[model samples]
Target: MTTSPAPAAPAGPDLTDEQWTTLVRARATDPQAVAKAYAARTRPAPLLSQKDTLFLVAADHPARGALRSGPDPMAMADRRSLLARMVTALDNPEVDGVLGTPDVIEELLLLGALEGKVVIGSMNRGGLDGATWTMDDRFTGYDAASIATNGLEGGKMLLRIDDRDAATAGTIEACADAVTELATHGLMAMVEPLPYHREDDGSLTLLKDTPSLARAVTIASGLGTTSAYTWLKMPSCDDPETVFGATTLPCVVLGGVPSPDPAQDLDSWGRALVQATVRGLVVGRALLYPPDGDVASAVEAAAVVLRAAHAGEDAA
Candidate 1:
């Protein structure tokens, strides 16, 4: 299959030679806007299409402390190392694109890795790493306006609803507003839905239970004013079918922390990705920071599973 040609920079208005030189210097302050404006001034080039592009490599693992597919916990802790590894994986031929937090996104932009790439921005960050406020899940990165100004392709937000947590209410309202803003910009808003459940001790937990997941799905689908750009990052529930039934939006079964058995873990994900509603898989640790050293092969293997499932459905 042929990859889509990258979008040509739009042409900008004519400027004198000295004016052009000054514009290049100003780009450091506002890269996104500068790039778009300059593109507008240039003649259109070969357009890159997004046809048959399905799987999105989720790079949001460091925030969750889920850095390895096996036993290591802090594998993704080193910012520079993780960025280098991600740049390597994303540059591979088979790896389609990436799903990452704003920090990673900005890094990718600076390293010149995002040109002609499918860049998905992460929306939540206030819920810090391994914190009690995980349930609150605030939208701290890549607002619609920022994404537009930066000339990004799409954005993603987390919606883990823990009714017991008061902050969930605020996140919900903020997400709704964000959805509207992102849609107006024609950017994708992939919403990950994990309904929160308080355990007997009162600590917050993600609900894999059927009823709770169904409710979360209902609420998630109903969010924002428009559903055009909305997508679902659903948990692979105990009863996978139930989670799959939770939403009509194109869904992706997230690769949660790896299980004790790696092969079994892959098999589980493979089966889940076959569900009709599950469009693709957004996995991080399992693919990038695998226990084994083959990062490129690991990513390609996961992509094979997703692409096979997606292609089979298309053929049918």
Candidate 2:
């Protein structure tokens, strides 16, 4: 049995032909270059930007097999397009950093798109999307040891709690340990804890109501030995105040499922941004695969919202 030569290096609008060739050659020959790049890349300072807020472009969705965006189920299936869009978003200086798994981060590092940008590695990708035990969300990606050794600024974990799923217990325990471990390294532990309801059909639905979100917030806030280095990555809810009131931990609003109407999505983020505890925005598909397919515009629009929120607070 013979394997066909690997398909031609993927191409994208912003992925120059030279860069594509470089990636191809690097993967085929210089695998160690990734570590070399990590060691040489310039790290960010103060973590958050001048406004004291994080503005990260999330690229960890693909790790869990969630490649849907808008009407396209496999919108993020193309590595070239995904990395190109991420590079476009990060090119805008206002965008502070990125949250991704090791593969995505390494690719971006090789692409030279992360210099001077804070990098947060995603943990807990074992619970693949659509798997029966997806709620487990086990730690299968970056561990604290690797994160520290790789010079990453932090680690992010997903904690989806379902009352009927026994796996949730183990997941919670794992996240707690991760939180403690990340903090022990003096690194940020960004925990995204969401309430999930399991239906009789075995499907899980996120509970976004005020009470549900508040409960989830409280649970995540109490994880690990200390909350000093813990931050929350949450979705914007109808009642931002009530939901955010549950904890004092600094929170960053995540752009969940994208809507065709970008205005509606930005509006929701604006509301959450004004909340005292909400500090930033970590978005992915909403900006990467916008309806218009303009990644830069989507990223700029989000940066504007972030700036406006902090400006409003200063004016107040």
Candidate 3:
């Protein structure tokens, strides 16, 4: 949003002059173009491109006030730079799809970056970053109906449980209702259940330990009337086997905090992908704003890891 000098974002896939003009024009005039674009866009079939695995780029963070990537506090504050990196990631042939909120997705739709890609709408982003009531991640984005009506393959909701917070209960309930609603439309309900512990000082921390993660997985696995159309979006951890052993639902590992070592991060994902239920990666900043500022290269590396994991699975 700012025009000031900020940290460099990933390079290439920059928007053309025409592309920028088209989006600006649409925003100023043609409001109905978004719906028309969705109706006419080619949809993906069989969802999973690699039979069992997928690799999806994610850009829904900005909506939730999560604009930081690495050391830069406002690294994702510039819409053009952020969207350009997203375009770069989606340009990779091996990338299966993308996950985003309405505004970002609408822009990409107008830019023609989402056609034939698996589009997942982010549902809850009401919990602002560092807010006191952050645990109340109310549904403020795409609801189940809107996601289906817009032709998205699924809807995603973030469920962070801080045991001490009462608001966590409402978030859990809302996510359950959303899962049921999405199931009625034959759409995927991708629930990201994260365990958090509110410190005495009021700071929150993600509990990525094996037991904490496994507990969160089981709790998410039972939402709604049925688990038939549900999938878990979980974080990868050491001893992934034990961490993910509690769920039979298909799972995808999300790229959480960006690490300085890309190869080390890939190795962590590769280990998680070994689990039969772990299908693929749904990564954002770790790929979009890599340390080297190469979006395509980061995406390609993720794809390679995904392919290798499935190949190893088949061989075994």
Q: Any idea what lDDT model 2 has?
A: 0.91
Best by lDDT: 2
What TM-score would every model get versus the actual structure? 0.79, 0.95, 0.96
lDDT of every predicted structure (CA atoms): 0.67, 0.91, 0.90
Query: Candidates sorted by TM-score, descending order?
Result: 3, 2, 1
Pitting candidate 1 against candidate 3, the one with the higher TM-score is: 3
Clashing pairs in 3: 1-77
Worst 10 residues of 1 by lDDT: 42-51
Model 1 residue 6 lDDT? 41
Local accuracy of candidate 3 as per-residue lDDT tens digits, 1-316? 8777655544545677888888989988999998898898888886788557778889999998998998778888878888888888988988888999999999999889987899999999999987887788999999999988989999999999999999899999999999999999999999999999888999999998988999999999999999999999999899799877898999999999889899989999999998989998999999988998888888999988888889966776
| Residue 278, candidate 2: C-alpha displacement in angstroms | 0.7
Q: Which candidate number would show the highest TM-score if scored against the true structure?
A: 3
Instruction: Rank all candidate structures by their lDDT, best first, as comma-separated numbers.
Output: 2, 3, 1
lDDT of 2 by residue, 1-316 (tens): 9965433222334698889789879988999999899899899978988788899999999999988777777778888788889999999999989999999999999999999999999998988888877787989899999999999999999999888888798999999999999999999999999999998998889999999899999999999999999999999999999998889999999999988799999999999998999999999988988777778888999999999999976676
Write candidate 1's Cα lDDT for 233-261 as tens digits: 87676676777776778777777766645
How high is the lDDT of residue 77 in model 2?
A: 83
